[model samples]
Target chain A: MQQALQQKVQKAASAIAQECFAMRVRYLNRSLTSIYDEVFRPLSITASQVNMLVAIITQQTLSPSELGGILNIEKSTLSRNLDRMRKAGWVEIDSSQPGRSHTVQASEKGQALLLNILPLWQKAQETTCTLLGSERSKAIREVADHARSEIMKT
Target chain B: MQQALQQKVQKAASAIAQECFAMRVRYLNRSLTSIYDEVFRPLSITASQVNMLVAIITQQTLSPSELGGILNIEKSTLSRNLDRMRKAGWVEIDSSQPGRSHTVQASEKGQALLLNILPLWQKAQETTCTLLGSERSKAIREVADHARSEIMKT
Candidate 1:
């Protein structure tokens, strides 16, 4: 069965059309993410920054490589993002390691913003979940997880 | 049941941390998107642009608003994206609406590249579906459709 399936669907072009799997997810993500992004607009922070805030808050400090792994983003991209976060006073990076990675942490301002945005995030999350229904959302998420793991492994 | 679920399991923050339906989808998207993005790196296009390529492949000359709807993205974001696409010669936008909306279409170059990338995309997609199992990928995509419909109404 595996061999047959492999033979039948073994091209990126063929899968690109079937991107409906990813497209719907992308659409919903944009919708929900845009709302949170708007809410954090006044703070000059992006929803991505919020993810950074959460990570720093939980770990107190993490090296960029570790942060990249946890964030599942490329190190270069993470470095660039952290550069912006550091400039915004949302986080700090210790770049003493010219060749090696260093630790990163949220700033005082960043931590405060997290507390401030917690309720807003909660409200938005609650509303969307309610609309999605817990059972339905859970099932969708489970499938998404399986999909993510499968794609990442390859 | 909806109301009860909301009350019983309205765990948005925890969900984002522990398990959010969108995270896996978003993760898979980011991962899959990054692969294509990296593949097209020499062309200097991002995953989002490759995604727009898919949009152009699907429809006739589209206005920003039309692309926004099909992509489930906002017009403002679409505006910037279309501008980039136009500049890159990947798309051409015609003022079909006479000051209202513009029609968009892929260029010769874009079509050629699409055909060029087909083989690479095939390998990526095939590997992913195989990793996920054909039945699992198919089942998950069906559920994604349901979730997308649910979100569109929301």
Candidate 2:
């Protein structure tokens, strides 16, 4: 029975390694994030942070939940990142807004940081595009769009 | 000059929101990871930990660097995860080997955890596959393979 269980587990492991969608997406995510992170290292900001800054600045202001929805970040994770960004002067909260939850917006420093990040981000983007090829790059965007739509439905 | 800089920054932000591959990938990664994480919550293991466990058990043993290479995890991140896994009694180190680096292997408890995780993992996998759809799912795997080959070359 023990031998049988081990064999079954091995089979399962092989299947997951070969065919799991989450595993592949996650692996690709890690690889791509590392590429961008390396390029953005001098700025002391990560790719995720850059994405957040862009979203915040573009929207002018957003409640935490709205930012979380746009980025697909969970509440706890989003809160932690926002706190870090606030400490870094990358974002500020507007508690004066008429709502139960405060709104977040990019601070002046954050806007300045994004300006500095543009050239470096372009280099990282070029590298990632080259790595993924145009076809897969397009496919990823489609998948993310699908995810967003599905998430909105719920 | 100030107006020009703001315009340029706004343009950059809009472009990134629309076309940045890293932004989309990171968003999808967060979304998909949350799906799997919610399923694996009962198991007290995360999707990432499950991935690490499978890799560890399949190889029977691997050095920290080797595991990191396979998972595309950075050294600091890998070390931190491993520390957590070790504390959880899921993996153990075998320092008996003749090398500067110690080898890591899943403990018996880890193997049992995998057995328990298989069904839960399948549920998460099916949910993710449904979310990504068949075509994008296959594309993600292909992209991951492309990334792996490129990384191996470097």
Candidate 3:
């Protein structure tokens, strides 16, 4: 009986060590970010910067808070990154409302850069898909969508 | 000829705006972190901190750099997180090497905390799995491993 109880405790401990969704995601994020970053290096943009650009381009325009919601990024992180993008002339922020939230859009320069990097971006995407396989790539996207919606339900 | 080339460019631009590995992973990370963070809030530990504890417990002992590599975490991030873990009385640092690197291990309190939080952690894991589904949960782990190995190749 004591041995069985000890084995259960051992199993619990191991489970705590192994089944970590956050860590797994973070590691995946880091690895994929590195691969994309390398591809974007010549363009002097990080994978993160491109992500923001893509969000702005796809949405046409978004308030910082709205972008945060869609990206599942922290408000502060979104603001900070936007600042960098604005400095880089990749994003334009309209603060005409003063106290109200600001609108963000991809500047012409950002659009041009996105176009210029398309081939490289495609290569990176292809490599990532090849590495992860189509099944996992699709599953990751679907799971990301489902998990984000579940978290936002609160 | 010019118009046809422009059309192709436009399609490529749109593709870049839609499929992004880094963005997808970041959203997944943020969502999973939020879920795990909420569950571990009562214990005053974030999902990330628990993840570190798990690594330390499973490894028994590991140097800072080794742990960082194993976790696919950046060196600076690992250092910062370890500082917090050490302060929380959940991790111990052997700084015997003085100016050099140090070994880390989960403290006794950390072990007890792990046991205490096992049920809650399991709930968080199960909830995340249900939200993402079993197939996705397993696939994420596999993809993470594959991506990490790919990143480490160079």
Taken over the whole model, the C-alpha lDDT of each candidate is 0.65, 0.86, 0.81
What does DockQ come to for candidate 2?
A: 0.67
* Interface RMSD per candidate: 7.2, 1.7, 3.6
Instruction: Judge the docking of candidate 3 as incorrect, acceptable, medium or high.
Output: medium
User: What are the candidates' individual DockQ scores?
Assistant: 0.21, 0.67, 0.51
Q: What TM-score does the predicted chain A of each candidate obtain versus native chain A? A: 0.76, 0.90, 0.87
Docking level for model 2: medium
lDDT tens readout by residue for model 1, B1-154: 2554333222333444555433454566666566555666766776677677777666645667767776677778888888988898988778756787677887767766676666655555566566566766675566556655765674
Q: Which ten-residue region of model 2 chain B has the weakest summed lDDT?
A: B93-102
TM-score of each: 0.73, 0.92, 0.85
| Candidate 2 lDDT tens digits, A39-110 | 999999988889899999899788999998888788888889989999999999887857689899988788
> For all the candidates, what are their Cα RMSDs to the real structure?
8.1, 2.1, 3.6
What's model 1's TM-score? Answer: 0.73
Q: TM-score of model 2 relative to the true fold?
A: 0.92
User: Best to worst by lDDT, what's the order?
Assistant: 2, 3, 1
How would you order the candidates by DockQ, starting with the best?
Answer: 2, 3, 1
Candidate 3: give the clashing pairs. none
